[model samples]
Target chain A: MSQPIDKQRRAFLATASGAAAATAVAPGVFLHAVAEAAPRDSAVSDSVRYGMLIDTSKCAEGCTDCVSACDRENGLDMLLKPEGASDQHWDMQRPRWIRQVKLKNNLTGRVTALPMMCQHCEHPPCVDVCPTGASFRRADGIVMVDRHTCIGCRYCMMACPYNARSFIHESVRLKPTATPRGKGCVESCNFCVHRLDNGGTTTACQDACQHGAIVFGDLRDPNSAVSKALAQYPSEQIRADLKLNTGVRYTDI
Target chain B: MSKIHYREWGIESPRYWGLLAVLAAIVALGGFATLYMEHEGHWVTGMTNQVVWGTPHVFAIFLIVAASGALNVASIGSVFGQKMYKPLARLSGLMAITLLVGGLIVLVLDLGQPARLIVAMTTYNFKSIFAWNIYLYVGFLAIVAVYLFTMMERKANRYSHGVGVLAFVWRLILTTGTGSIFGFIVARQGYDAAIMAPMFIIMSFAYGMALYLLVLMFTFNTDERPLGDMVVRRLKNLLGVFVAAIFYFTLVYHLTNLYGTENHAYEAFILRDGGVYTWVFWLGWVLLGMVVPMGILFHPALGAQRGAITIAALLVVLGGLSAIYVIVIGGQAFPMSMFPGYTVIESGYYDGVDGMARAYSPSLPEFLLGLGGIALALLATFVAVRLLQFLPTSLADEVVDPHLAK
Candidate 1:
C-alpha cells in the first residue's frame, strides 16, 4: 500500500513539475498573467517616495466619494456600531481613514473643499513620540502604525497636527484582510498600502475621484503625475512652517 | 542632640483597619473599572478619538509628579543637611516609592493594551521622550529603594547622603522627563513651550510637599507621636514657596503665550472662554488650588495652627490635580490648527467646533479609576508604615530641632 501511494505521489510530482517548467519558459503563455499576479517578494524600495497632490479647485463640496471609497477599501465601513451607542457618539468614536474637509478662508471668505488624511511627513511627530516605535514611516514615504507593537497609548493622537490618525475605540468584529484592525491600536491612512504592495498603481480614493482632484504617484520622480502637478501647480504643504516636508501636497486652496 | 528613634505604626486600632479596608475596596473598584474599560474598549467611557486620554492620565500624572515631590523631606534632610527634616526622611522615601507604584499601576492599566506593558518595557525608542520616561520611572524606583536601604540599614547609614543625592538628581530628571512628554510635542500650542519642564518641576515640589506634610501629620498624630512646630513650620513654609513658585510659573507661562500672536487664540481659550476648562483652570487650579492655599499657608494667624495647615495641604493636593487636569485634558481639548488661515466649517471629525474646544467629560468609571490610584497610594503608605519603622517614635520640638536638642 505504501509503495503504491509513493508511486502515485511521484507521478503527480512529475506532472506538476512539467507544468511549472512550461510556465517558467513562456510565463504568461501557459499561466495567464503569472508574473503580473506574483507578489512583491523583496523589501519596498526607498527610491520611490510615494505622494499625493490634492487640487482643491477640482474638489467639489459635498462630494464624499474619496471618503466612501476609502471606507469601502479599508473595511472601515464594516464596523458595526455597538448596540445602544448613540449616533453622535458613534460618529466621534468610529475610525475614519479619510474625511472631507470644507474650509473657508478667514480673510477671503472663499470656501474650499478637499479630502484630508495623514500627511506622511518626513519627520513624523507621531513616530518620534510613540514609545514603542509602533508609528513609523515606510521606506516609500507612507506613514503607518504597526498594530503589533502599538500599545495604544494615544500619544501619537495628541502629537498629530492634522488629526489624521484615529484610535479603535471599540472592539473590531469585522475588518478587511488587507487592513487588519483591532481595538487598542492607533491607525491612519497608509496611501492604500495593500493596493500598492499588490502592484496596483492607484489608491481607492484616487481611483474613486471622478474629477481627478487627487493625484497619486512617486514624488521622487519629477516626471510622475504628482511631481508634474506639484511643478505645474503652486502646491503647498499644510502648515508649511512645520517643515515636515510632507509627502501630501495641496493646490488652489 | 538626642538620637532619633523610629517605630512601626502599632496602633492596632479598628479605625486603622477601617481605613485600610476602605482603600482596599476602592482599589478593587478601580480594578473592576479597568477590566470594564479594557473589555468594552474606551468607548464605554467618554474617551473618543478626539479625547484619547481622559481622567486616568490626570490621576497617573499627578501621582507620578507627587511621587517625585514626596522625597523632599529626605532630600532636605540628607542632601541639604536640614537636621530638622532627618527624623521624617524614612517616611518620605517610603511615600515616594508607594505613590509612584500606585501611579504607574493606573498608567499601565489605562493603556489600550495593558497586557502589552512588557512590550513597552522591552522596546526602546531612544528619541521618544516617553521611551526615556520608562527608564526614568524604573530607575527612580531602584534609586529610591537603594536610598531607603542606606537610611534604614545601620552600616549603610554612612552612604545615605551619597544615595540621597543620587535619588534627588534622578527625581529632578524624572520630573523633567515627565514634563518633556508634553513639552516635546512642538505643534500643540498648550505644551510646545520649554517652560513646561521647569513648571512641572516646581509643580512637583508643591504637590509633593503638600502630600508629605499631610501624611507626616496624620501618621504622627494618630500614633500619639508629637510632630513639632519646628518641623511643621519648616515644611509648610517650603510648601508656601512652592505654591508661590507655581503662581510665578503660571503667570510666566500664560504671559509668554499671551505675548505671541500665534498663541493668542489658545491662550484666550484656556484663560477666558474654554468653558469647563477655563473654570477648572481659574476656579479649581488658581482660586482653590493656589490662592486660598497660599493665603492659609502664609497668613500669620492661620499658618501656626495644625488644622489650618492640614486644610491648606489638602487644598494644594486638590489644586495640583486641577492643574494636571488642565494640562493633560485641556491641552488636548483645543483643536489642532490644521488649516492655519482657514476655518474648517465642515468635516467628518469634529474640527473647528464648540469654540474649537472638544468636549471631554470624565465618566464615572474614569473618575473611579483615578480615585482608586489615590487610595492605592495611601493604602500602601499605611501598610508600609504598619509593617516597618518608617516613622520616628516622636517629632517633639526638642527631638527634631537641633538647636533645642543641643
Candidate 2:
C-alpha cells in the first residue's frame, strides 16, 4: 500500500494543481482535467479520496443550490440569472458551476438529467495544451487553472474538445462584484475549492442532488461508491473515444 | 546598348490623405477601445458560450490568407516566366508582409490574455489543431518577412533571392496547415468538411489578387507608378483561376456534406435552410464572392476591360472577406447540437443556442481593436518601404540584376 516519495509528491502536485487551476474557471465549471487517482502520502491514509457519483436520472429539476453554493464558497460571484446588460461578465456570465443537463437521445427518444461540472479527465487536453504550464490536473483527479500565471491566450479554449474554457473578455463597463472575475484571462469550473479545504466532499452538486443520485469517492478504492457504481452498473463518459480518461462517469436511470 | 526604360518603381504623389486621416482617426479611437477591453473583461464583443470565436477571428484569418496569396505574383514571376508582373513585384511583397502582420496584431488583441499568446506556442498540445496553427502562422510570417527583406536588398551583394524563394515555398505549406485547423475537425458539423483547407488556399489567392488590384488603383490615382495592361491582365487571370477553384471546392464541400449519410446540423442550416447565413453563403459567397466574380473574370471579353476587371477584383475581395466572416461568425450564429427533436432552434433568428445563451455582435471596442490591427499593418507597411527600401525605386533594378551575387 506504499510507493516512492517522488511518485507520492507527483500525485499531490497533480491534485493540488487540478484544484488550483479549477479555481480559475470562468464560464461556470466544466468536467475536465483530472489525472489518475492514487495515494499521495500515508499520513493521509483513510483519506477516502472523495468524488461524486452523479445519477443523471434523478438530479433535481431546477434548484441550482449546488451551482450557487459553489459560487458563494469559491467566491466566484456566479449568476443563476445576470442582473442587467453590464452585469454580465465573462467569468460568471451564467454561473452554473454545477448544472443539470437535460439530455435527449435522438435515436432512443429517451430523456435524462445529467449534472455537468469539471470531468477532471485523466488525459486532459486543456492541461496538455496549456502553453504557459498554467493548466494542471491532480493525482486525486481534479483539474484547475492558476489565474495568477494565466496569460489568457485562450488557446486552451480551442484545445478543449469539450468546449469548456471561457475568456474573461473586455468587460470595461462591467462593475464586477469583488469576486474572482478578472480581465484578460481564461476561467472555468473548479469543484468548490473552499469546500475541499474544509474537508468536505465536493458539496455543490452532491448536497443539491436531492434524490441521492450523486456519489463522490475515490474510484481507486474498491469500497468507494464510484468504484462500486462502475463495477455494478453500465456507465458512460462524455466523448469516451477521445481517450481523455475522464474521472466523471454516469449510470443509467 | 541601353535598357528599355519601362517605368518608375517608387510611390510618388498619392492624395489619399483623406483616407489616411480617416483611418488614423479610427485607429486612435480603436486604441482607446483596446485599452478599455484590456481594463475590463470580454463584455465588449457579442461572443457567448454559443458563439465563442467570432467576427474578429474570421477577419484575422481572412487577412492572413489574403496576405499569403499576395505572395503568388512574386512566386509566379520568380518561379515562372511572367515578366510583366515584375514592376509591381515589390509592392505585392510589401503588402503581403504588411497584411500578415496586421492579421496577427488583431488576433493578439482579440485574445482574452494577449500576453499569453506565446504560452500556446511554448506549450505543445498535439491534440489541438489550433496549437499547430499558431506555430505555423508565426513561421509563415517570419519567412515572409525574410523574403520581403531579401527582395528589398540593393543589387550589390544582395543575398535574399534564395531566401525569398524558400519563404515562398514555405508560405504554401503554412497556408495548408492553417486550412487543416478547421478541416481536420470532424466533430463540428460545418467544419468537418476536409476541402475547407484547399478552399482556404484558393480563397487566399483571390484575396491576394483583389488586394494587388486595389493597390494598383491607389497607385494610379496618385500617379506613383502606373502598371502596364499586360501585367494587370495576368492579375485578372490569376484571380479568375483562384475564384473558380474556390467555387469548385465550395460546391463539392456542401454537396458532399448533404449527399453523405452523416446528419450535419451546421452545414444543413447554412447551405440548405438557414435564413440569413444561407443568403450569405449562397448569394454573398456563392453568387457574389464566387460565381459573379468568376463570370466577370473567366469571360475573355470582360478580361479586356481594366475598369470591368477592377470591378471583378473588387467583388472577389469583398466576397472572399465576407465568406470568411460568414463561415466563422454565421457558423457560430447557428445552434449546435448533435441530436434533434427537442425544439431545436434551427436558425430562424440567430436567437443563439439554448434560450439562455446570447448572440455575438462586435462592440465598438471590438471594432476598434480590429481597426487598430489594420492601422498597425499600414504603419508597418509604410515603415518597411521607407527604411528597408522594400519598394522598387528603379525599374532598372527590376531587370538590371536578377542575382545579387557580386
Candidate 3:
C-alpha cells in the first residue's frame, strides 16, 4: 500500500528542528527571530470590519445552545454570588454576554426567537457616553471595554440602547485565559476576538448553533460569507430607527 | 455707610461641638457604607444593570447644582452691583466650595473603581459630556476659590468685580454642563431634551437659595448676629421667583413631551403608570416641592413671617430631593425601547419582562449614604465658619440699609 507523506506537518517539524538548532548555536539571534515571528500581525486594521448575520427564520424557539456556549467561552459561568444572595437574585446580577430573546409582533401575531448581544454599532452610544474612554471600538469594528480603565461608573450601561452591556456586580473566579473579567467593570460580547486572533474563523456561538442561524465573517470583504448573505438577503438591524448602523444584522425578524 | 465687620463663628460652646460631633458621625457612617458597598461590589445596593445610577446620584447632583446656585448671592453683589448683597458674598463663596467638595466626595465614592479616579482626572474623552463636566467642576472650584480671596483681602477688592463676573459666568456654564449630563443621553426617552439644561439652572437657583437661607438663619441665630427683616424679605422674594421659574420650566418640559407622539409612552409612564415614581412626581415634586412652598411664600398671612419662611425653605429642600429622585431613578426605571412594536415575551436577561418598568427600592445604606453627603456639606460649613471669618457680624436693617439708619 502506498502512503502519502504529511507535507505540512513535515514542514512544521523542519521549522521546529531548525529553531532548536539555531537556539543551541546562537541564543541571541534565535531570541530575536522568535520575537520578530511571535507578533503574528496582531495589530487591528480597518480593512476588515468583522460582523455577524443572524437568520432568525432558522432560529428555533427555546434553543439556548448559543447562550450556554457564550457563557462557557467567556467564563461567565464562573461568576459567584454574594454570601447571602438568592439563586434567583444571582441569576439577574451575573453578567450575560448573549441571550435568546423571544419577541412577539403585536400587529402580525407572529413570534420569533433570536440571539441578542452587542450590535457593535458604527456609532456606539456606550463609547460616546463613557467618561474614561474605557469603552472603545477597535479599528476592526469590535466594541469592547478596557477593564483596566473602566472605573465601573456604569454610564455606558445607561447609554447602551440594546442593553448589551452588563456590570460585574460580584468578584469572578476560575476564568479562562482567553477572557479576563473582574468586579466593577462593564462587559459585553467581543465577537470572540480571541478565537479570531488564533486564526479561527467562527465564534463560539456560531460554532455551537445546530440550526445554522449565525454567520460570522468580515463585512468589508465582498467575498466574505457575511457580506454575501447581507447582499443577497433583506436583513434588519434591531433598532434601525436609532440609525446606529449596527454591524450585526438579522434576517426575517 | 457704616464699615461692616466680618467675624469667625468663635462659638466654643459645648452645643456647637455636640452639633459638629453629630455631623461627623453621619459622615463616618456614610464612609463606612461606601466601603461596604465597594468591598461587596454594587450587589449590596438596589442599583442593578438596569438602574445603574441609584439614590446616591440624586443627592450628588442636587448638592452639585446647589453649589453653583449658592454662589448666586455673591454674583448679585459683585456682578449685578447690588450693594445690599455684598456682605453676604463671602459666605456665599464659602458655601459654594464646601457644598461642591461634599457633592464630589459622594460621586467619587460611588464609582465602580474609586481608586481609578486619577485616571478619570487625567484621561480626556472630549466628546463625552461627562468629561466636559469634570473640567467644569474643577474650574468652578478654582474660580470660586479666587473669587473668595478677592472678597476677603482689601488689596484684592478692586479685582473682586472682575473675578466675581468670571465666577458668575463660569457657574452658568457649570450648571448647564450638569443638566447636559442628562440632556445628552440620547438613549433614554425621559432625558435627551434641550430643556434639561435651563431646567437644571433654575432648579439650582431654587435649591441653592433655600439651602443658603437655612444656613444664614441658623448661623445668625446661633451667633446672635443682627439679621434684619430687610435682607430676609429680599431673599425670600427672590427664592419665590426661582421656585416659580422652576415650575414654569417643568410645565414646559412635560408639555413638550406631550406634544410628541413618540414621547407619549414616556410621559404616561412618568406621569401615571409608574407607581412610586408617580407618587414622587405629584406629591414630592408638585405638591410639597412647588405648590405648598409657593402657597406659603405668597400667602397674605404667612409669606412675611420669619418662621413661615424657614418652614417654606425646608419644604423646598425636601421638594428638590423629590424632583431629583423622579428625574434620575424614574428615568432609569422605564425600560429602553429595543423593538418599538414588539413585546419581549421571554429573555435570558431582564428585558423588562413584558415591556414593564424595572423595580427599584432604596436600601438603608443607600439613604444613609445620601444623607451622609448632606451632613458632610453642613459639617464643612460649620468647621470653616468656626475657623475663618465667613459670617458677617451683623445684617441689621439700619446697618445694611444706610437709608434706614438715616
Candidate 4:
C-alpha cells in the first residue's frame, strides 16, 4: 500500500498560497501537507505507519553510535547518578531507550550484533497490561507511555517480551525539550517521535549509523525506504513466535 | 441447642496494651519507610529494570490471597451448613476485611507514583487484569462486611447464609483474578500457565486457614475463653489436606512446564542451578514451610496439642511467604529469552548474561513497608475484636457441637 502521492502538490501549494490556501483543503489532506512541510504542530495520522529495518550483518560490533545518539536525543544521558548509588546499581536502575545487543547462535557459533529497542508491535503486551491506559499506541503505530497518567506499577515492564521498556528509578533534574521524563514512569523507544513530528524523515539512531544499517520510514508506503529495505532483504522480528507483527525488522541475525 | 452469645475482648490487660503498642509502632515504621522510598524513588529498593516487583508484592499478594481463604471458615458454617464452624464465622468475616485492607494498602503504597493512585482509580483499561483486581478487592471488602453484619444482627441472621454464599463465590472470583494477574502474562516462561489461577486458589485456602487458626488461638487464649479440641482438631486436619493440595498443584505445574521443550531452561533454572531460588524452593517452601508443618499437623500426638498446632500454623505462614517469593521474585529473576536459540554474548542491559539469574536483594525500606502491612492487619483485627463483639463467648465442645453437648 502507498500513501496518496501528493508531496509535490502539497509542497507547491505550501509555497504558493501558504496557510490561507491550506484551510480550503480537507483535514486529512491538510495534515498531509503539514507533515510534508515540517509544521511543528500537526496531528499525526494513520495514513502512515512508521517502522524501521536493521541490517544486523552490516552493524559493526562494539559500535555504540546508535545507542549514544538515542541517549542524547531522548535526554537519557542527562540523568545523574543518585546520591550513594553504586555504579553497578546505577547501571541496572537507569532508563535506556536503546542498547547494543550481541548474540551468538548456540549451535552454529555465529556472532551477530544489533541495537535492541522497542519492537513497536501491532499487539503490544505492555499496552494491554497498563492498568491506567498510560501505555498507548499512536495512530501512526508508535507505542509510548503517558508519564502524567503512569502510576509506575511496572506491570508494563513485566509484560514486555522484548525487555525494551525501563522504569526511571530516581528523580530526573534535566531533560530535553523533546522528552519529559521523571521518576516512576515506564519509558521506551518511540522511534524519535519528536523528530517525526517536526517533519524530520530520519531517526537519531538511523542518522548516527555510519554503516547505513538502520532504515527508518513509513512501512505502509511501499515506496518508502523501510518498506524497500524489508522487501529486498530477508528480515525477521526478534520474537517471531509471539506473532506480535513488530514494526522493527532485522536481517541476518 | 444453647444459643451462642458474642462478646468483645473486655480485659484491658498490660499484655493487650503492649501488643497494640508494638503493632502501632511497626505500622508507624512502615509509614516512615514508605515515605523514604517515595522520596528517594525505587532506586533505594532492590527492584531494578529487570525485577520490577519486589518484597512489597510478596507481602501484598500473600495477604490478599489469605484474605479470601480467611472467609472459608464462614463459608463452611453458612454456605456448607457446618454447625460446628458457625461460632467462628464473625471473626472469619472480620479477618477477611482486615487482611484485604492491609494488602491493598501495601499494593497502593508500593507504586512508583503512589500520589497518582487517584488516576488508577478513575481511569481504567478493562482489558487489564490489574484493573479487574481493583473491583475484586473493593467488592470483597464490601461483601465480607455485609456478610459480617448479617451474621451479627439477630433480625438479619436469616439472610446470613445467602450473603455468605455470595461472599464465598466472590472470594473465589477474587482469587481467580489475583492468579490471572500472573497467569495472563504470556511473555514470561515462569508465568502464562492456566494452572496458576487454580494453584493460587489452593494456596489461598492453605495460607488463609493457617493465619485464621493462629488468630483464633491467640484471641481465645488471651480472653481466657474455652476453645474445644473438636474444633481445633477439625481445623488442623483441614489445614493438612490444604497443604497436600498445594503439593499436587506444584507438581502438576512443574511437570507441565518440563514437558515443554521451550520451557526446559526455565524449569532447570528454578529446579537445579538457580542457587538462591532453588534453595528457597526446596528449604523455605518445602522443608520448613510444608514438610515440617505437615509432620506436626498429621502426627496423632503432636496434632492434638495446641502448641504443636500453633507451630504448624506458623510454619504454613512462613512457607506461604516463601512460595510467593519464589513465584514473584524468582520468576522475574530469570530473564525472558528474547532470542530462543541464541546466547546473548554481550549487551548493555543484563540480557541474562551467560544465562545467569538477575540479582535482587530486598532493601530495608521495602521490607519495612511489607511488615507494615502485616502489622496493620494484626492491629485492625485486635482493635475490631476489642471494640466490636466479633468473638463468641465460648467455643467449648458442648456449646459448639450439639452431639458433644448431649
Candidate 5:
C-alpha cells in the first residue's frame, strides 16, 4: 500500500509542468493544479471561500471587543446558564471562534498576545480520522462538527493535534449564567460557521481589530490584503513542522 | 412454602435474604442518582475540568480489565484443559460476565450525555483510540456472553464446543487489546506497554477468583461437604500465580516508563516523590495490591487453611481495588507539560490530593453511586442465581473437589 502511493507521487510529479500550461480546462486535467490552487494565500475575493490571518506583534492586548462581538452574535452566553429544572436544552461550549493565547517567548523576554483558535488545516486530521463521519471538511475548507450525532466518546480529544477540543463534562443549566455552558460530547473552534454562511466579510476577530492587525480574504483571488501581506512579509503558522497545510496565517507585526 | 433442599453440590438452606435487602437498597440508591444525573447532566456528579474523568471511568476500566481475566479461566480451563485453573473455572466465568456489566454501568453514568452513548457505536472515529476501546469493550462482552451461554447449554441444549474454544482464544486477544488502549498512549505516562493488557487479564482472574470464593463460601455455609478442601487449594494456587504475574506487570510497566522520554512519563516520576499519589502508589498498590496478598497466599498456613485463604481472598480484592485507584489517578495527576526543565503546571487540589486548586473528592452521592454499581452487580447475580441456579446443583462433591473426583 505504501509502495503504490509512492509510485503515484512519482507519476504525478513527472506530469506537473505539462499540466501547468494546459490550464484553460480549469478545475482541470492535473491534480497538482488542484493542490496549488488550494491556496494558503490571504486573498479574499468575491468568491464564497473565506480565511483568517492573525497578526501577533500588535495583538492589541486587553481588548476583548472581538470576544464580545462573538458572544453577542453567536448566543454563546445562553449556553453557560446553570441547569434549571425547566430547561430541556443543554448548553454547548460553543467552540471558541477566536481565543487569546498568551505565549511567553523565553529567549526574547517578551510575552505576546496571540489570539489563537483552530488552524483549520487543509489535511485536517480530525475529519480524516472520524470513523463515524461526524468530523468533516467542506469543499471550501471549513471544518465542522455535526453535534447532532456526536457520541460523547471524546476520541477526537485524544486525536487533536491542537488541544482544540473540549468535552462538555457537565450540563449547561447548572453553570453560572455566564458559565459558557457546554455538556456531554466535545467542541472547539468552528471559525464562526453561522457568520461565514451568511456571507459576512470577516469573523468577530477581524471586525474587532482596532489596528486592522487582523485580515480575512480569499487566497484564490490573489489580490486580497492577506495575499499581499504574505507575499511581502515574513511570518509563520504555529507548529509548521506539523505540516497540516492550515488555512490560517500569521504575521509577526 | 418450605425451602427446597438438595445435596449434590453441598446444598442446604441458608438465609442470604438479609444480604439481598441491603444490596437492593444500594442498587436503588445508585439507580436513583444515575437517573437524576441523566435528567440533569454530569453536573450532578462531582467531576470538573482538571478531574474531568474521576471514579466512574477509573472503576469502569478496572472492572472491564478484571472481567477479562475472570473469563479467561473458563475459556482456558473448561475448554483447553489448563488443569491448574480447571477447578475454579465455573465461578470465574460467572463473575467475569457480572463484573463487565458492572463496569459498563459506571461509564454510562459518567457521560455528559448518557443517552448519547449509543451514538459512539453508531458514529465512531475509526482513528481514535477512544473509539476503538468502546468497540473492543463491547465485543469482549459479547464473546463472553456467548461463551457462558454455550457452557450452560449442555447436551439437551444445542451448541458446539467450537464456539467455546473460539471464546477462549478471543479472550486472550481481547485482554491484549484492552491493555494496548492504555499502553499505546505514548502521551499518557501511566499506560505504555503490551503488558497492561496481560496485566489486566491477570487482574481480572484475581478479582474473579476472589469473588467466586466469597460467593462459594456463602453458598456452602451450612453444607456438610464444605465445597471441598481440594477445590480451595486449587484456587489459592491460581491466586498465587496471578499475584506473581501482576507483580511482573507492575515492574515492567514502571521500568519501561523510566527509560522512555515523554511528559506523562516525567510526571509519573512525581508519583514516587512523596506527592498525593506516591504513598498510594507504593503502599496501596505495590505492598497491598501485590506483595501482602502474595505473601499471605505463599505461606502454607494461609494457603492450605480454608479460613486463611478466605481472609487472603478479601485482601486480594482490596488490593485490586487500590491498584485501580492508584493507576488511574496517578496517570491523570500528571501535569500537561512533557519536558523536565519547563516545570509541570500545577493547578488546584484536583491535580494533587492537596494544595487545593482543582481538588476533587468524590462527593457522598458519587461514592454512594460507585458502591451502588457493585451492589447492583451482587443483586443482579443473586436474583439470577435464585431463578437460574448458575452454580451447578450436582458436581461430584457438589462444590467441585478434585480430591473427591479421585
Candidate 6:
C-alpha cells in the first residue's frame, strides 16, 4: 500500500510539473502570485513596507477632504458628546486620525498646506514606552494599537512626538465595521490596515484627495508610485532631526 | 549601652478616631472621583490630547519618588551603620511601603482602563521603561518588606545589612527607571536630557527626607514621646543637604540645556514666557520650595525651632509638587517642532497654533483624586503605627545618643 501511494504521488508531481512547463510562466512570478493569494491572517512579510509621500505644494489651503474622509472611514465623525459636555469641550476631547495643517515659513513667509497624521516611525517611541506592548508596529510598517492590551495609561500619547494618537474620552457610538474603538483606549492612524487587509491599496485620505497630493504604495517596490515619487522629488520626514526614519514623507514643507 | 525599646502607639483618643475618619472620607471621595472619571471617560478631567497627564501625575510621581527617598533613614541605620538612626529604621520602612502603595493606587486608578490592571501586570514589554518600572516597583516593595522584617525580628537582624544594601541598590535603579520614563523620550524637547535620572534621584532624596521629618515629628509629638534635639537636628541637616543637592542638580540641568542652541526656546518658555509654568517654576519651585525651605532650615534662630522646621518641610513638599508640574505638564504644554523652519498657522487638532502653549486647568475631580492618594498614605502610616511596634517610646538625646547619656 505504501509503494502504490508513493507511485501515485510521483505521477501527480510529474503531471503538475508538465503542466507548469507547458504554461512557460516564470517560477518567480508564479511564486509571487501564490504568495499574494495566500490568506490575510498569515504573518505579514517584511518584503512589503507600506509608505506614503505627500506633495504639500499641490495640497489646497482650505481643503479638509482628506480629514473628513478619514473621519468617515474610521467612524470618528459619528462620535457624540457626553450628555452635558459643551461643543468646544467635546471638540477637544474627540479622537482625530488626521488633520489639515497650514504652515508658514518664518523667514521666507511662504505658506504650505498639508494633512498630518501618524508618521509611522521605523523606531516608534509609543511602542517603546507602552507598558503592555499594546502600541505596536506591524511587519509592514503600520503603527497601531491593540485595543485589548491597551490599558489606557496614555504613556503612548506622552511618548508620541507627532501628537498623532488620541485617547477615547467618552463612550463611543456607531463605531464603523472597519475600526473597533471604545472608551479608554489609545487610537491613531493605522495607514488603513483594514482597507489593506480587504485588498484595497489606497487609504481613504489618499482616495479622497482631489489634488493627487497623497501617494500611498509599497516602499520596497521601487516601481511603486510612492517610491518613484520619493525618488524623483526630495522628500523629508517630519522631525528629521530625531532620525525616526518615518514611513510618511512630505515635499515642500 | 541601653537597649532601645519599640512600642505601638496605644492612644485611644477621639482625636485619633477623628483623624482616621477624615482620612477615610478623603479616600472614599477620591474613589468616587476616580469612578466618575473612569465611567465618564477622561473628558471630565482637565487632561487633553495635548496635555495628556495632569495634576494626578504630579502628585503620584512626587509620592512615588518620595517613597524611595523615605527608605534613606533605614539604609543609614542598617547599611551605613549609623547607631543613632537604628531606632527610627522600622518607621522609615513602614512609611516607604505606605507611600509607594498610595502613589501606585493613584496611578492605576487614573488609567484609561483601570480594570485592565491585571493585563498590565501579566503582559511583558522588556523594551519599555514603563514595563521595567513595574518590576522595579514590585521588587522594591518585596526587598523593603524583608528589610523591615530583618529590623523587627531578632533572629533576622544579622541579615539586615545584606538586605538593606540590596534595597538601596534596587531603589537607585527604581528611581532611575522612573526618571528614564521622561528622559528616554527624544521627541519632546524638554525631556531628552540624560540629567533627568540623576536629577530625579536627588529630588527623591529631598522630597522623601522632608516628608519623613514631618511624619516623625507629628507622630512623636502626638504620642507624647520624647523626640531628641540631637536626632531632629541631624535629620534637619540631612534634609538641608538633600534640598541643596536638588538645587545644584536643577542648576546643572538648566545650564546644560541653556548651552544648547536648540533648547533656547524651551528654556525661555519655562523661565520667562510660559504663563503659569514660569510662575510655578520661579515662585513655587525655586523661591518657596527651595530658597525659603533652605533658609529656614539653616537660619541660626529658625533652624533650631521645631515649628520652623515643620514649616520648612511643608514648603519643600509644595515645591516638589510644583517642580513635577513644571516637568510633566509644562514639558508637554510647549508644542513639538514638527516643522523646524515653518510655523503652524492653523491646525485642527489644537497643535498649538502660532507657537501657543496648550491650555490645562485641573478639574475638581482631579484634585480630589490627588488628595485621596495623600490621605491614603497618611491613613496607612497612622494605622500601622497604632497596630505595630514600629516607633520608639522616646528618641530623646539621652536615649538615642549614648555619648549624651554618658
Clashing pairs in 4: none
**Which residue ranges in model 6 land beyond 4 Å of their true spot?**
A1-38
Off by over 4 Å in 3: A1-35, A38-42
Residue-level error in angstroms, candidate 4, position B218: 0.2
lDDT by residue for model 4 over A1-253, one digit each (tens)? 9788788998988787867666677787977786677765567788989899999999999999999999999999999999999899889999888989999999999999999999999999999999999999998999999989999999999999988999999998999989988888889999999888876889999999999989999999999989988999899998899888998999999
- Model 4: how far is B387 from its true place, Å? 0.3
Task: Kindly report which residue stretches of model 2 are placed more than 4 angstroms away from their true locations once superposed.
Answer: A1-52, A78-92, A105-109, A128-130, A159-163, A169-181, A193-200, A241-243, B1-19, B116-134, B154-161, B184-187, B338-358, B382-406
Per-residue lDDT of A8 in model 3: 98
What is the C-alpha lDDT profile of model 2 across B1-406, one tens digit per residue? 1232423324442534554666678668767876776755555566665466766677678778888888887777655636645445676777887888888777777777777665655765455566666766778777766666565544621545576577677777778876876665533556656688788888888888788777666555454443445556667887888888887888787778777654466566777666667777888888888788878887888877877887888888778767886777675555443223433222211223342223456677776677676676666565454454444433333343444314
Q: Select the stronger candidate by DockQ from 2 and 4.
A: 4
By DockQ, the candidates rank as 1, 4, 6, 3, 2, 5
Clashing pairs in 6: none
DockQ of 4: 0.63
lDDT of 1 by residue, B118-233 (tens): 99999878889999999999999999999999999999999999999999999999999999988998767798989999999999999989999998888888888887898899
Top candidate by lDDT: 4
Every candidate's lDDT = 0.90, 0.64, 0.90, 0.93, 0.61, 0.92
Give DockQ: model 5.
0.14
Residue A136 of model 6 has an lDDT of 95
- Candidate 3 interface CA RMSD, Å: 1.0
lDDT of 5 by residue, B66-138 (tens): 6776665576666776543443445566667777788778877766666776776677666655567677667
Question: Candidate 4 — what's its lDDT?
Answer: 0.93
Docking class of 1: medium
TM-score, B chain, candidate 6? 0.99
